[model samples]
Target: MTATPDIVPPTEVRMAEIVFPNHTNHMGTLFGGQALAWMDKAAFLAAARYSRRAVVTARSDQVDFKLPISVGQMVETVGRIVEVGRSSMKVEVELIAEDLHTGERKLCTRGHFVMIALDENHHPTAVPALPADIAGP
Candidate 1:
């Protein structure tokens, strides 16, 4: 069985965002758990795009909190399907905070999410190869 490549091209990355609010905070900054949740969601979306099937988080690797996201800031999550196996995908996801008015960007957190493709019965299923152009150099 051939393993998927370790890297995926930047173009394959999918980006999404949500505005921060008081309720999304714990200490005047976006909560770490909230960031993790969004990262997982974005990773799942990226993995599903290639798997063409339902995917669920099987693991998270080395989640690092590098900066703080403040209220009214837009939290943008970028996710990419980096590696694939018989039934699993490794998605690299980054969380960034953007100034709403100025559009400035800062990376807040980054992590790798391992997702498994699921069949109709919710059992693990195989994932197809990513297109050549979308794959890494």
Candidate 2:
């Protein structure tokens, strides 16, 4: 009898970007749209990594901007798969801002994104179930 090797997939993805003048708004803080774009990209990468398949954003939910991220600050975005279905995954993404000189960090924004795995034909495709040990609510 042949045994199937257990393969654990990645559940999280992190990306970093430095806030620049062009990325800010008139108030000198990061723009809401730019933040959303970054969060979506992080979610896409996390879902793709977990599923090992092409993925697309299905929706974004409850994005809250808690703090202002000023220009010159470093932003670190993290995405983690929280829920998984046959063809979709819910990823929780957070953006943290850190002052380069002071090293002070704070959570600036948080949101949840739903991503759907897609096949070559652009139809929904099944994804592997998350490991029980790391599965989220």
Going through the candidates in the order shown, the clash numbers are 0, 0
Candidate 2 accuracy as lDDT: 0.97
Residues 1-137, candidate 2, lDDT per residue (tens digit)? Answer: 99999779989999999999999999999999999999999999999999999999999999999999999999999999999999999999999999999999999999999999999999999999888898855
Kindly provide the TM-score of model 1 when superposed on the true structure, using C-alpha atoms. 0.82
Top model number, TM-score: 2
Candidate 2 off by > 4 Å: 1-5
What are the Cα lDDT values of the candidates?
0.81, 0.97
lDDT of 1 by residue, 1-137 (tens): 99988653232455666655743665778877778888888988888876779989999999999988887888778888877789998898998888989999998899999999999999998887666765566
Q: Would you list the clashing residue pairs of candidate 2?
A: none
